[model samples]
Target: MGFFDRWRGREQRASIEDPRVPISSPNIITFLGLDAISASGETVTIDSAMGVPAVWAAVNFMSGTLAGLPLHVYRRTDEGRERVKGGLATILHDAVNDETSSFEWRKHCFDQAFTGGRAYSFIERSAGRKVTNLWPLDPTKTVVKRESGRKFYQYKDGSRTHRYDAAEIIDIPFMLKSDMLQHRSPILANKDIIGLAQAVTKYGAKFFQNGGVPPFVIEGPFQSPGAMTRAAEDLSAAVQKAAKDNRLALSLPAGHTLKQIGVDPEKSQLVELQRFIIEQIARIYSLPPTFLQDLTHGTFSNTEQQDLHFVKHTLKRWVEQFEQELNLKLFGRGNTRQYCEANVDGLLRGDFKTRMEGNARAIQTGQLTPNEARAMDNRKAMPNGDDLLIQGATVPLGTQPVMPVPANDNDEPKADAA
Candidate 1:
């Protein structure tokens, strides 16, 4: 069947089987659910987890960094493959750039994939069977269910419901396991850390607001009826006024002794506790302690390596997931040769002098043509720049015999007398 026809069929089938609708059969029932809880009692969800600074930093940093990257599409041929444009490339590069920029779309995709373990986007096609636009779907409201070995998506958008087949949606799942149905969310896996972080944040806030006040016991020798009660009330009122107005003094009646109590903030080790919690939260998100502005263990040389580690160890997996999903779903089945790749060279690029030296070396070693190397620096190519030049001393690795050169006859003119 054609793409649109198959889509229509799936929609009709999904509508008929949709349990949300009122059907004559009494056995039918719809189970509306969303995965929003973790092992802890806290509500561990994408939005909630983002409230934690560490999580927000991790998600925002990754999404924004990846979105700024360039995702290029290439078509494979018998001889070689070349970068393609004006088809899938154009669609992905600025898909709905007028309303939703490509960077925003990519950021959303990465954010969803990282926090929820899956990201989804609805594919809009034109009458010519070309994908015209892409729209992100909230992973929380969208449900992925399988029936009769066929997987489909049911999305709840406000009052209306949208159904899409596997072909009509872009699914980027992270850490997909043997279930082959869904991916495990990193946020969910580290719910305890998130809860503790939030709890510590709340404690810190309360600590600052009430830190000046110290608990104490009021003792007096008043033996009259309601004397102790009246004294306690007056003392409470004075303390409250002092605390609320930031007063430095509190009056006490004669023969009354005030004993200070409660643990001090320093004695409680709140700073150390908070630091430990931040590091743990950072670890949960696969972020180095340094990235979260915790430079306790960071060094000058190690910082550069840490940045590289962030790109390679952490960000590469997310980038590859996006590339593979776009290649597979955007190009459709049987188009295995054509694929998309996010150019991450920008992230790994060095300083200007270092970059120029590396490019020059590449051109000299024939690894890249002069024109190609110049293009890397956004410089125009020169005449004959396309020619690949190699060092005169370098040749194929093999044994060769040297040949003798013949002498010119003009140099033997001195022997004419003989």
Candidate 2:
């Protein structure tokens, strides 16, 4: 390999897409779904907990966030695996890190290329090789030390079968394929004169899926189940209280507020009770608008962070004030977190209309999906009436029907595969 050829090989590897690799199904589904949903939710790529695709859902938690980048890699028997992987990764890693392609964008591509981080199915035709930007979960690096008797180690890729530990060429089911193993399932994972340790193999699988470079532990997912549940529950309760608290915060008239009609305002906590009431009254009687700028009013980082209680209290205070002054009903909580209707409608001073107009323009300009357009229509009570079967996409629970979404005639894309 001459210096110039090597240099050209490196230079040839920009963010250019490899023509050889076939797009995996997982990759297609994620990117398309994200495009559809983003239009519907009016959400950008950075929203937390917004799993545009299963890319976020694939990882247990925070690692999912980091995994949003497309990892360019070249794998195969071309005797250029290391060089190719390194070269491609260099351009891709930098491009992604610099946000030339946003985290969401790279993630979108990865899902398309690897079928949602399953397998790096790179098929070769002639004296060819396989390569991809994605890999099995483990992709873990390893060091083997032959301590006298046996030789083997486990692979860690964060799948059930990643538990294979052997000094020899161990085979395991790929996450994408989930059926066969590259080598063997239960390879050697013995310590000292040790034979096989199931736990050892499991550890290897974990190490591989997350990352094996330095081999670190990812404990964040432990809190995901609990924290997500609590956050949802807490937010639900707080919104319900916003009616009364909102009125009080805006100092609106209580007689017009809805909370006084069914429940006693005095029974609730001072801050919370006040806020909800204010919000409700403000809504009923049409009050002026307020804005929320994400301001860092303080200097120190060690101070108490904002949590459920603080949010609830703040909501309550705003609602309570509105009720005291406006004497109107406002702010009801249920599935969606909505602002006070009347306050929003009247006090918006045509801001709502203007925003809607802009949203419409965005839609007309090839930025919206049918589902999104339908949702927007439903919001304004302007019926589009296009509900075929169910709302939202399919949930993965092993067995379920996956009917293809009807594509538009005019805008229907010429699918590469079909």
Candidate 3:
């Protein structure tokens, strides 16, 4: 089936299986009924987990940042490495296919990886064995299996099953299980943390929904269980009415006394708990809390350090993983001359002054030519900027300059004497 047709079918299937619709199959019932339940009593599926601000922020931050990076293909030359511009390079750097831009393709793949634990793309090659396009496959519908000691990707498209060789698919898993073929989802693996966040948020919302009142029990003289229930219902109505009327106090029967049963949000430290959950989510993605918008402990200096930490530790790891996977699948294991890479120089573009200063230093130190540095900022090169330059005063450390000898003291007077 065509991509859009398959997507439309999937959407239709999802709509048909709406939660409100009843299902008879035990498996479907269980899947719809008991999504990953955490100790905090919150359902922690990918959709519910994403409802938590922290998880949403972390996933979007990582995936969007990665997708925004400049990806390129390069060839190793006798002089140095130079970027390859056509064919596969164009497919990677611009559009994976005529329908999708490179950014959207990468973002979709990474969004799957961050949320579902795995991302996959089918690489289409022409008769000449050159990559023509990359089509993303839904991880939920794609299964990886080993047959005859060879790995294969089986993708389910409606009623049809399409199979591809492992080399034809680019697979990135958040982490692998012991079986190697199966993967572990970050959301499923750390559902408890995400669940707690959801639970806390729900609690806060319900608390406010019911007039900012903590759950409480009524104590008084009651003749029967039914009477106690009636008294409780009356008090609940009174509380809601008071809140609706914007009253500061709630009236109760003379003999009945109300006592709070559950801990208040402040006492339970709900805000602190939320912040901690954000930190935990950040940890799951190897990101700093600052990236997730948890600035409780973010200082200017440490946040700057965190930016460096993110690039060096988290971003670089994923970049290398993606690069290696692309190189292997696109060029084959035997090919080494051509490779793919993510250029991270754009990450520093936000700090214009600092970036320009660093580029100037590189140019002055002969580490980069003027034109090469200009290319980083997407500026046109100067006519004479191709040459690598260094400070004129810079010389070998131990070398001494030849000094012109001073004329003898009497030599200046020789003309006058004549």
Candidate 4:
């Protein structure tokens, strides 16, 4: 049975009002938020996970970086490959539909993928089998099933259900389960770590919310429980009043003494713990610590290396996955001529000096025409700039330079000794 089907069955069973049913049942736990409770005792749902600054930064950095890139469709040709323009290319590079730009659509898709562990988009094609538009689908409402060696997507939308062939859906999963149809959510997989971060944040907030006072106990002699409770309330009022009045001294009765129950944030190493959690989050996303703005150990040289690492190790994998998925679903498995690719050159567009030097080297090595290099910088091409140029001073190692010979033997220079 599908997840929602099982959920409905549980709901129906829970509605029978049977006193024998345990409160710890799945439906009860889900309704009471117990299912979301993490090891640290913090509820770590998708929304709560995003509340952590480190997670927020990691997801936005990855998804936004991908969305900001330019995705283009290209065609294979005998003379290498050429970019395909218009039609599907326009949809991918400019706008997926009238309402959605390519960037927004890509960002939304990746946001879902990074958090929910899967993203889906519906490919709308014309009767002629040409793509016309791309529409985003909610991963939560969709279910994937395989039958007879073919996959199908069944999406529930309101009172209607839409079924689509696997070919019609663009599905990207963070990681597939054993069945290959269900996916493992990144947030769900590391809820303990995220929950710890959440718990620490809440602790810090509550600490400050109570005027920077830790939990404390009053040690005093009291004849009755009511007397002790009244004395505690009076002490609480005094502390709050002192804090509000900005007074340095907290006055208490002679017999009453406030004993702090827990260590201060500094003694508890909260700052270090937070930084460590940031590094853990970075690991979860395969990102460098610098990417998460945790530069405690970053130096200039390593920071530059981290930039390269991000493009090569982290971003390249995601870019390739997205490109392959696009190619497969949009063009089909048998397609060889048409494909999609993300222009990640923008990711390395760092300092102007560095970019200019790299472009110059490419031009001088005959790897790129002058005009092609100019296009990278958004500059107009110069006349005759289309020709590839190389340094004229260099020659092949084995070949000797040609020397001019005299037209006749008489024209040859004689040795001074002769």
Q: Best candidate, TM-score-wise?
A: 4
| 356-397 per-residue lDDT for model 3 (tens digits) | 899999998999999999899899989999999888986788
Looking at model 4, which ten-residue stretch has the lowest summed lDDT? 14-23
TM-score of each model, paired residue for residue = 0.78, 0.17, 0.87, 0.88
Question: Model 2 misses residue 108 by how many Å?
Answer: 4.3
Q: Give the alpha carbon lDDT tens digit for every residue of 140-163 in model 1.
A: 789887888998999998999888
Model 3 segments more than 4 A misplaced: 1-35, 396-399, 402-418
Pairs of residues at least 3 apart in sequence or in different chains that clash in candidate 1: none
- On lDDT, the stronger of 2 and 4 is 4
Each prediction's RMSD to truth: 9.9, 32.7, 8.7, 5.4
lDDT of 1: 0.77
With candidate 2 superimposed using the best TM-score fit, by how many Å does residue 106's alpha carbon deviate from the native? 4.5
Which ranges of candidate 2 are over 4 A from the true structure?
A: 1-86, 94-102, 105-127, 132-259, 264-299, 303-418
Give me the runs in candidate 4 sitting further than 4 Å from their true place: 1-35, 397-418
Among residues 3 or more apart in sequence or in different chains, the pairs in candidate 3 whose N, CA or C atoms overlap within 3 Å are none
